[model samples]
Target: MAQQLGGRARSLQEGPGEYRLDNGQHILIGAYTESLGLMRKLGVNLEQSLLRQPLRLRYPDHEGLSLPPGPPLLSFVRGILSYKTWHLSARLQLLARATVWLLQGFRCKPELSVAQLCAGLPSIVRQELMDPLCVAALNTPSSQASAEVFLRVLHDALFSGRGSADLLLPRRDLSELLAEPAQQWLRVRGTQIFLGTRVHTLKQAADAWHLEISGAPQGETQCFDQVVLACTSLQAAKLAEPWAPAWAQAAQALHFEPIVTVYLRAPGSALPAAMVALNEGPDAPAQFAFDLGALGHAPGLFAFVISGASDWVAQGLKETGAATLQQALQAFNWRCSPEVYRVLAEKRATFACTPGLQRPGIQVARGLWAAGDYIAGPYPATLEGAVRAGKNAALACLQV
Candidate 1:
C-alpha cells in the first residue's frame, strides 16, 4: 500500500549491499501462503529462489524425523511408524496425543505453556522434536512458549494442506531473495524510498502525521494523510506514546527474546542434509545448524542458530561462538577444522511469545496503523506474520 499510496519507505541502511552483511538465517514452510503470494507478486521465482523438500529434521548423527510426501495425515502416521529412533510405544503415545489435539480442534488454554501441553510425551520426542520445533517456530523455549500458538502453528503446517509441511530453504542472501525484489517492485510502482534515513520524531496534527527526519541537513519534516509504523515495537512505542498511550503501553510492556547466529567456515565440509537439528545444552548453544553449501552458498560455510538465546547472549558473542565451534567439531565429521567466521546476535530478535502475552494491535489510532511481526497475531515473530500484518494494515488503511 505504501507503494501505491505515494508515500516513502525509510531505512537506516543504504541498501542490502551496504548493510545486512550477515543476517540471521530464516526458513519458510508451504503453510506461509501469504508470504509466498507476496513473493510471487514481487517477481521472485519460487522454484529457483527456494529449495522445496519434504519435512525432514536430521540430526548430526543422521537420526531424526522425515515425513514423506503424501496425504498429510497418512504421511504423518507413516513417518511416525517408520521412526526407529523412538520405541513403538512412544510413537503410539505421540499419535494418541496428536489425535486428541486434532479432535479438540487444536485449541488449548491461553495460559498453558507448550511444556505443560506435551508433558506426557516421551523424552526422546521432547528432546529431538518438540523442544527444537518450539524454539524454531516461536523463538521461545517450550517451558515458556504459548501452547495455543504452537498448536495452531502445528495445525496449519501439518493438517492445513498436502504440501504445507514442506520446507522452503532460501538459496541466496535475504536481500537477493526477497528485499531487493520488493524494493524494485515498489520503485517500479512509483513508491519513493529514503535509504539511510531515520524518522526521529512523529507528531500528529489533526488527522495527519508529521514526521521529523533524523540526520537531515536542514531539519526536514514531512506530512502524510495516513501513516503505518512499520518499525520495531520499542520504536513504535516511543512514537505513539504521546497520542496512542494505550497502544504504546501495550507495545512497551512486550518483552523480547534473543537469537544468535554463529557462522563457521570449514572448506570441503558439509552436512547430511541442508539443515540439521543440534542437541542444545550447556556446551552446545546452537539448536539448529544450516549447511550453506547445500543451500547454494559458499561451500563449507555453515550457520549455527541459537534461538531463545538469553544465556548465550550474556556469555558474550566470542565465547558463545567458540563454544558453538567446538560443539560443531564434535557433532559433525569435518574435512578440515572449522573456525568461527562471525557471530551475529539480535538481542531483541522477537517478542517473547509467552502464554497470554498481550500484544499491541494494528490500529494505533485513527488513520494510523502498525505493521510488524510483533503486532497481535496468531503466529509468532516470523516472516509470514510480518507479511500478513503488512497486507492487513494496508487493507485497513484503504478501508479508512
Candidate 2:
C-alpha cells in the first residue's frame, strides 16, 4: 500500500552484467503459509517458481540427517534414528532432548540462549546440526540466539505436519516471486502504483494523517484516515518520533546482524543436492551453499551464504570471498575452479535474534500502525514473519 513492496526482504538484489542473482540468498520453508498464500493470491505460479524438496541436511559426502516422506512425527523419528553417521548414543540423546522440548510445548525461558539450553547434548550433534540450524533460523550463533525462537522454528519445521519442513528453493528470481506479481496484483485492483517515491515526513492532523511524500502532485500533503508505516524500522522511527517517542525509541533500540552472500561462477559444475549444509570454522566463512544450477535457475552458478557474519564482516569482503572460494574448493567437486562472481553484504540483514530481545510492536498510535519482520512476534525475523505482520497491521488499520 505504501510502496511497491509491503513487507518484502532486501535479500533479492541485482548483480552486475546480465546475470540477475539473489544478493542475500534467502530460503523459504513450507511452514511459511502466509507468504505462500500471498504469492498464490498474486496469481504467481508457485510450482514453476519454486523447487520443493524434502528436508535434508546432506553434505558433500551425503552424510547428514534427512526426513523421509510420511507422517510428520514418524518421518522425524525415522530420520533421526537412521542417521548412521551419528553414534547411537548421540541419536538417542537428541531424541530425548527433543522429547523434553515437545513435552514442554516447545516453549522456553526468554532469557535462555540456544547453547545454554542444549549444553549437555553431544558435541557432534551440536556441531553438525544444532549450530548451523540456529544460525540459519535465527541468523545468530547458538551462544547468542534465543532458545524460545529456535524451538518454535524446530516445532514448525520438524513436527508441525507433513511438508512443513520442505525447503522451497526459488527457481526464479525473487522479483518474480514477490515484487513483480504483487505490483501487478495491486495495479489490477485500481491502486495507484508509484515507483521511486519517498515519504519525506508524516504528521497527525486534527482529523486525518498527513504524509509529505515525494510523488504527491504539486508537493501536496496526502491525507488518509489511517496510515500504515510499512517502511524500514529506521525510517518508521524517524516518522513516528513526533507522534510516539517511546515506540520510536524501542524501534531504534533493536540491534541487527549482517548476512554475506558470495556467488561463484563455475563453468559446467553442479552439487550433489540443491542445497547443502556446510561446516563453519575459524577459517571457513560459509554455513550453507546453494547450487543454482540444481535449482534450475543457472547452469554453473552457486551461492555461499554466511549468516551471523559479524566476524567475517570485520575481516573485509575480499578476504571473506577468498576464504569462501578455498572452502568451496575443498568442500565440493567442481568441473572447473570456481571464481568469485560477486560478493554482497547486507549490514542490517536482520534484527539480532538474541535471548530476551525486546522488539517494537505493530501498534504505534491510534490512527497509525507499523509493520515489519522486526516487530514483536513469536517467529524470528523472516519472510513469514513479515507477511503475517503486514496482514495483521492492515487488518487492524481497516478495523479502526
Candidate 3:
C-alpha cells in the first residue's frame, strides 16, 4: 500500500489501530479489503450513478437509456398501490399521511415552478415516494429535499442497480453498517481517521489551518495539507469564528433535529424477528424496531428506532422508550419492556428541515471547506448528503 501511494503514505501511520467504539465494545483492526472484494463480487456498482450523468433527467421530457419507460412507471404505480393498503406498519402509515398532506398543500397553492415541474415530468415519474418521516430524519423534509437532490436520488434508486441493492439489504445497526464502511474506505484510500479525538477548535495560519483537539492543554495544533471541516453546522460555525465571523454567523443559523433509538433485550421467545414497522394505531414514540440478533447481535435484543423526534426530547428516556415498547408489545404480543435494556438518544443527530435554511457552499472561507450531513445539498441531513458534501469539499480543496 505504501509503495503504491509513494511518499504520500509516509506521514500516515502504517496498519490500523484497535479502538473501543460506541457501547464499549472493542473493534479489532483488520484490512476490510475483503469487504471491498465482496462488494466487487456482488457487482453492486456502488458508485454514485447520478455523478456520472448530472443532467440526464433534469429536463422534463428527457428519458434515458436505462429503464423501459412503461416498466419503471408500472413499478412506481405498484409501489403506490402497495402503500395504499392499511396493513402498512404504523411508521409507513404516518409517513403516507404526511406525504399526502404535503403533496396536497403543494398541489393546491401550486407555485409556478413546482407546478411546471409537476406538469412537465413524465406521468410515470409523477407520483414520488415522498416519505417525510425519513426526510426529516436526515435534516430536511421531503418537500425541501430540492428538485436536483430528489432527481439524483430517484435516478440512482430506480435506474442504476446500486439503489435497489441498498434497499434490499437495509442493515439493522446503522453506525456499524454506514460509518464502518466509510472508515474502511478512507483507510484503504490512504486517508487517516483519528476517532475518539474530538476536535475542539481550528485556527488558520499563513498557509494552512491548525486543528486543536480535546485532551490537550494550552493548545496542540497540527497543520494539515488541506483541511476539511466534516462536522455539524454548529462545529463549523465555531471553527470559523476566529477567521471568518460572518461565515460563522451564517452557519450558526442552521438548526438540527434529534434522533433516538431504544434497544430491547427481549427473549427470542418474545418475538420471532428483530425488526418490524407498524403503520396504524396510537402515536407511538418509535416507528420501527430491528431484531438486532437476526442482523448479527445477541438474540435477545431488538432495536427500536425514532427519527426527527423533536416532541420527545424533554420526556424522560424511561418514560418515552417504555411507552414505545408497551405499544409494540401490545400489538405483537412481544413480551418486552424498556426496563430490560438500554435507550440511546442522539439529541443533535441531524439538522432540521425548513425552507431556505442557510446552507453555505463548500468553500465558505478560503482554504476551509465544509462537509458533513449539514453542508448545502438537495437532501437535508442524510449519510448520502454527507458523502456528497465530503466529495464536494474534496473537489473544492483540489481546485484550490
Candidate 4:
C-alpha cells in the first residue's frame, strides 16, 4: 500500500490546465537493468516509452563529451580523446583517474567525497563532467557526495555492458512510464491496491502481522502473513520503530536534498538536442534542461532541473524561477520570449548521498521487509535503486 499513486514519481496538473508537469526530470541510464527489465516484463514498450541515445554531455553551442558507439571502455577513452574542448593533458588526467578507479575495481575509501576523488583533475573536466554527473546521479554535490557510490555508478554505466552508458529519457508522462502500468499489472494478478490508504501502525501477532490502518470503512486493522513496507523512509521508520528501533533510527538519520524543476514555455521554440547540459553558476540555478518537444511530449515546453538545490530552495521559488528564466534567455535563442511556466520543488526529493552515510536494510521484522530508494544498497537513491529494493523484498517474502 502506498500513500500516493506514484510515490514521488507522477505527473501533476497546474491551474486546472490540460498540460501536466512532472515533479522533476528523471533520467535513466541503460545500466538500470532491474528497472528496465521490470518495465519490459510489465509489457511496457521500451522503444515507444523512452528515447535512448549514447550518453553525452552536450552543451547548447558546442558538443562536450560524446561517447561513440563501441565497447564501453574503448568508447569512453575515444570520447575523452576526441573532445578538443579540453586540453590533451586534461583528458589524460581524466583517463588516469579512471584507470586508477578501474584498477581498484571501483572501490574507494568510504569516507572520501566525490569532489576529493576528482580533485586532482583539471578544473574544466571537473566543471563540465564530474560535477554535473555527480549531482545528477547522487543528488548531492561533489564536495559531499559519496565517492564509493559515484564510482559504482561509473562502473555500471561505462564498464558493465555495451549499451549500459546510453541515456534513456522518458517520452511519456512519468506515471504512464511506470507507476500506472505497474498498478495495472498488479491488479490483473489479483493484488489489491489501496490508494489513499495509510498503514498507521504495525503490530506483531502470533498468526499474522496486524496493521493498524487509517480511514478503513470496515475497520482500523488489517492482517497479513508477510508484509513489505514500500512507503517513504519516514513512514517505514514509524511502523518499524517498535519492531526494529535500530533500523528505524538509521532510516531517520538520513539527510535529504531537494530538486527543483523549472518549466518554461516559449512558443515554437526548439532546443538543439533532446537534452542540454548548462553551465551552472551562482546565478544559474539549473544544471540541465530538457526540450520536452524533442522528447515526444508537448511542443515548446522545457524543463530546467536543478539537482541538489538547497540554496535555491532557500532563495524562494519566485527568485529561483526568475533566475532560471534569465539563465534560459542567455543560453538559447528563443522563437519568442520564454516565460516562467512553473517551478516545482521536491524538498525531500532524495537523501543526501554523502560519504559514510548509513541506510536501513530491507529486513525490518519477522516476515516483514522494508523497501524504498532509501534502503541500504550499492546504488544511490534512484528509480533503479527503489525498484531493485522492492524486487529483492518481494523475492525474500516469497521465500518465507
Candidate 5:
C-alpha cells in the first residue's frame, strides 16, 4: 500500500502480505480528513461484501435491528435531540427505530414522511446497502448510542465532501493498529514516545516540572511551558497532582467504563462485511464484528467487538472471549470453528455517558491541560471525541 504525503508517494507496506491489528482493522483510505473525503467521493465498496446477502435480521420493524434505506442524518438528529441524557435503555430503542427508517429511505426512498420513517423493519437488513460504518466509527451502537454524537460524526464525514469510505474493523492484535501509526506520527514529528518509560511520580519545580519515570534510577526530568496529560482519567489524575492538586483530585473522582474486543478466525466460515454489529440481548456479552478477510485477501478471519463490557474485563480470555464469539457465530448460524485469535482488554475504553459527564472542563489549571476520550466532550469515548478533545486542549494551551 502506497500512501501519498506532500504530493510524494510513500510505501505503506513495509514488510507484509498485509498487516493486521488485534483490537480491530483500520482501512486507511488516505490521511485523516482527506482520505475520508476521497473514499466517499470515489464511492463505497460495500457492494462487494457479505452484507449484501439479503439475510433476515433479528427485528425487521424494530429499527436499527434492520438496515435503513438512506443515511439517517435527520432522524438520527431528531432521535438524539428528543432523547434524555445518558438513558441507554430508552435511547437505543429510539435509535434502532431511526436506523430502520433510514435504511428504508436509503433502499428505495419510499416516502419522505417521518411517520413512514418511523415504521419498524422486519429483518436485520431491510435494504441492499447496510453500511453501519458510521456506527462503527463512533463505537456506539446505532440502536442505543446517542444521536447527537452520531450527528456530529456524520457532519464531519459529509462536511469535508470528500469521497472517502472509512470502515472500522477488528484485527487479531491491538498493537498492529494503534501503536505503529502513533509511533510513525511521533517519529515524523520528532516527539519522544516512551513506551516502557511509565511516569510514576510527578512534581513541579520552580521553573520546570519534574517526572519520575519507571525505568530510570534517579528519574530524568523534562521542561516545557505546558504539558498535555493524554492518558486515562485515573492516570491523568496522578500526572496532574503537583500542578493542580484539587483539580487532580477531582479528575481522579471521574468514573470510567471498560470495553472488550474478542477476535475470532473461523477458518472455513465467512462473515458479511469487513465489520458488522450484533444486536445482543440484555445479558449477552459480544456486540460488533469485523472481517479481516475483507482487507485485500485474508480468509476465514473475523473479530467480535464487545463495548461497555465491564463484566468480562478480567475474566479468562479463552473462556469469555472465545465462548462469546462462539455464541455470536451461532447467532449468524455459522459453525464455531475456532482458529488463531486473541482478546483485547481495554480496561478504560470510556467513561459513563451521563448528563454532566460532558461538563468536565478541559482546562486543568493554567499551564496544565488534559485530552482524551474520557474528558468532557460532545459524546462518549470515541476517536472523534478524542480528536476533538485533543484539538480543543491544544487550542487552550496555545491561547495561554
Candidate 6:
C-alpha cells in the first residue's frame, strides 16, 4: 500500500547490507497466501525465493514427524498412525483427539489455553509436537497461549488446501527477498521515499490527517486524506495518544514476548535436515535449529532460535549464545567444533498471545487506521498477519 500510495518507509540501518546482518531470521509457509500474493505482485519469483518442503520436524538422530504428500486428511492420519517415536496407544489417542477437534469444527472457548485444550492428549505428543508448535506459532508457551488461535492456524495449514503445510525457507536476506523488492516496485511508480525520517506527531485537521516529521533537512509537515500507522505497537500508541486515547491505552496494556536467534558456524559440517526440532529445557534453550548450509547459505552456518525467550534474555545474549553452542554440540554431530558467530535478540519480538487478551482493532478512528501484526486479527503476529493487516488497511483507506 505504501508503494501504491507513493510514500517511503524508513529503517535504522541502510540498504540490504548492514540491515540484513542485524535482522532476525524468518520462515514462511504456503498457508501465508496473502504474503505470497504480495510478493508475487512485487515481482518476487516464489520458486527461487523460497525453498519449499512438506511439513517435516526432524531432530537429532533423525527422530521426529514428517508428513508425506497426499490428501490433507489422509496425510495427517497416515502420519499420526505411522509415527514410531511414540507408543501405538499414544498415537491412537492423538488421532482420537484430532477426530474430536475436527468433528467439533475446531471450536473452543475464547478463554481456553492450548495446554487446557490438549490436556487429554498423551504427554509425549504434547511435549514433542504441541509445545514446539505452540511456541513457534504464537511465540507464547502452551500454558498461556490461546487455543482458538492455535486451532485456526492448524485449520488453515493442514486442512485449507494442498501445500498449505509446506515450509518456505528464504534462501537470502530478508531485505533482498522482500523489503528491497517492495521498495523498488514502489519507486517505479513515482513514490517519494523518505529515508531516516521519523514522525513526531500525528493530528487530524478537518477532513485530513497531518503528520509532523523530523530526521530530514528542513523538517516538514505533510497532509494526507487517510493515514496508516505501520509501526510497533508502542510507537503507534504514542502517535495515536492525541486522537485515539482508548486505542493507545489498549496498545500500552499489551505485553510482549522475546525471541533470541543464536548463529553458530562450524566449518565443513552440516545438519541432517534443513531444520530440526530441539529438546528445549534448562540446558537446551533453543526450540528449533536451522542449518543454513542445507538451505543454500554458507556451509555449517546454523541458527538456533529460542522463542518465548524472556528467561534466556535475562541471562544475557553472550551467556545464552555460549549455552546454546554447548547444546548444539551435544545434540548434533559435527565435523569440527562450532564457534558462536552472533546472537540476535528481539526484546519485544511480538505481543504475548495470551488467552482472552484484548487487542485493539485496525480502525483507531475515522480517517485513521493501523497496519501491523499486533492488531486484532485471526492469526498471531506473523508475516502473513502483517501483510493481511496492510491490505485491509489499504482497502479501508480506499473506501474512505
Q: How close is candidate 2 to the true structure, as a TM-score?
A: 0.96
Per-residue lDDT over 1-400 for candidate 5, one digit per residue giving the tens place of the 0 to 100 score: 0122210111133356543433333333111443223223334333332122211122211223332222334433453444343256545655576565355433323122222332353332222112243234444344434444444444443232322222333222333233444456667888755544566766666755566666544456655677777766788887777777777877777665565666666766656555455655544566556666764345766667666565566565566675676566555645555654667665655564432233346878767778876676554565545656777899888887
lDDT of 4: 0.91
- The lDDT values for all models are 0.86, 0.87, 0.49, 0.91, 0.49, 0.85
How far is each candidate from the true structure, as Cα RMSD in Å?
Answer: 3.7, 2.0, 11.1, 1.2, 10.2, 3.2
Ranking by lDDT: 4, 2, 1, 6, 5, 3
Per-residue CA lDDT of candidate 3, range 22-85, in tens?
2211110011123333333433343421112111111112222122223333444344444432
Minimum summed lDDT over a 10-residue window in model 1 is located at 3-12
* Off by more than 4 A, model 4: 1-4, 15-17
Leading candidate by lDDT: 4
lDDT score for residue 393 of model 2: 98
Error of 2 at 210 (Å): 0.7
- The per-residue C-alpha lDDT of model 5 at residue 227 equals 73
Which predicted model would earn the best TM-score? 4
Clash pairs, model 1 backbone: none
lDDT of 1 by residue, 300-394 (tens): 78989999999999989999999999999899999999999888888898889999999999999988899999999889998888889999999
Per model, how many backbone clashes are there?
Answer: 0, 0, 10, 0, 44, 0
**Please, what are the lDDT tens digits per residue for candidate 4 over residues 1-400?**
5444787888887666557877788899999999999899988999999999988898988888989988878999999999999999999999999999999999999999999999879999999999999999999999999999999999999877898999999999888888888989999999877776789899998858999987676589989999999989988998899989999999889889999999999979998899999999999999999999999887889999999999999999999999999999999999999999888999999999999988889998889899999998989999999999999999999988
Evaluated at residue 293, the lDDT of candidate 1 is 88
lDDT of 2 by residue, 100-214 (tens): 9989999999999999989999999999889988999999999999999999888888765778888888988777788778878888899876666788888887868999988
TM-score of every prediction relative to native: 0.94, 0.96, 0.64, 0.98, 0.62, 0.94
Report model 6's TM-score to 2 decimal places.
Answer: 0.94
lDDT score, candidate 4, position 326: 97
> Where is the poorest 10-residue window by lDDT in model 4?
13-22
lDDT value, residue 32 of candidate 1: 93
